[model samples]
Target: MKHVLAIGAALVLAAGVANAEEECLEVGSPVGAFYVADVTGPSAGTKLCYRCKFKDRPVVSIFAREVNDQVAGLVKQVDGVVGQNQDQKMAAFVVLLTDEPESAEGQLKTVAEKHGIQNTPLTTFDGVAGPASYKLPKDADVTVMMWVDGQLKVNESLKFGELSDSKVSAVLGDTEKILN
Candidate 1:
């Protein structure tokens, strides 16, 4: 009886892990248009659709619930990548999901300036749940979706406390998938 119970528990745990690893946006899905308030981008102080603006270009879109050090680090690295890939028209943006978009705007600006983030735009979506179409999981603290020529190539979701240094490196490496 004990052995059976242990096996059942292990199977349950493995199933949970598998579900978490599943991509939020299935690979190869068409990237859709969604408008966010551009806080620190070329179109600052306006609501715009980055997906529309960067159509058919390689893009790295990050949605984060909060701007912590790890999230900031990821954005900074992505900013560098965008700058390097300008010739390829690679673009990236960070969308902060919050109920209080007014308050989040200031913090987004600070993070951009502090990190000297010049290439990627830091924008805000006016809800914690994010765009209805994206279907961002409530438990996901950070979700990264990359696309090339309007088709998603990578979708990675990281829960709170899961965005470690190695994970950031792995995410940056995924940029190559889209860039190519």
Candidate 2:
């Protein structure tokens, strides 16, 4: 009985330590911030930052090469759900990964407009390094990271051409639980 109790206590301590080590962006990771035209906000430009902004609200950040119809739909649904839950403080952002971000803005804007996901903040980041900084797989085309109170809550990835309806719903459900 004594040995069993000791082992249980050790396991509990290890779990606590593991959770403590898991932060949204580890110290020294690139800030990965950029300014972009607002699709919904009244402001002309909004500076989206992984480190500075969304301090208090739970942030669902989608890192993708393009905001396709499926991705936009998922974000729209999650945004609506979060909007309905007044008790939950949350924000959604799409970080487009591209080599030529300036040129890609028009395309991203069009995609957002087409899918009616204008409410979500959309911008572009330089390379895979941005997503990798958050520990996403190098080959991942889209990675969703949800953070609450500066802690890492969810880090999910979907390969290029792999964003299915079921996967999107699962991710949103996970985010909902975290916000709750």
Candidate 3:
């Protein structure tokens, strides 16, 4: 009976370890990719704080706080892509601001109207709420898109592969144990 109980306990622990690993694989990081796991204060201001491993390269990260000041920051980020390659926009910006989801969606639509970002070659879905998803670009397999989930009331993306929820919660969670 003692041996049987020990075996059962071992199996349970093994299952738990497997689940924990699965939790991180949902979104799928690239080979040799790793996230910063933690950082100091947010970068700019909009809650973008993340440091993700991106396969064989030094870990890559984005600072959300920097986004609170959107106009200059967005321009710089998108333009940074252009500057780096000087051809196509290197990254796509998915702006998620506003204290409320409705307001955030409204702003996206408004910006699309005024700035003509609607349904263009690059610009896909407008600001709809909840369960929002997008496909990975062929080249953007290396990049990540960040947005707000007003329903779950968190920030997440399809980019992080398996780490999406936890990573997002780290950004939005009220818990003390977060990277930054």
Tell me which of candidates 1 and 2 scores higher on TM-score. 1
At residue 31, candidate 2 shows an lDDT of 36
Better of 1 and 3 by lDDT: 1
At residue 112, give the lDDT of candidate 2: 62
Per-residue CA lDDT of candidate 2, range 75-169, in tens?
77866766665466577777777777667677767776676664466777666456444654556778887766666677777785778888888
Q: Can you write out model 1's per-residue Cα lDDT over 1-180, one digit (the tens) per residue?
A: 999999999999999988865626688888889999999999999999999999999999999999988899999999999999999999999999999999988899999999999999999999999987776777899999999999989988888589998999999999999976
Q: Order the numbered candidates by lDDT, best leading.
A: 1, 2, 3
Which TM-score value belongs to model 3? 0.29
Candidate 1 C-alpha error for residue 132, in Å: 1.5
User: In model 1, which runs have C-alpha deviations exceeding 4 angstroms?
Assistant: 1-23
lDDT score at residue 168, model 2, on the 0-100 scale: 84
> Model 2, residue 97: displacement in angstroms?
0.9
Question: How far does residue 123 in candidate 3 sit from its true spot (Å)?
Answer: 10
- Model 3 Cα RMSD, Å? 14.8
lDDT of model 1, residue 80: 93
For all candidates in order, the CA lDDT equals 0.92, 0.66, 0.30
Pairs of colliding residues, candidate 1 = none
RMSD of each: 3.4, 8.2, 14.8
lDDT of 3 by residue, 142-161 (tens): 22332221111112333323
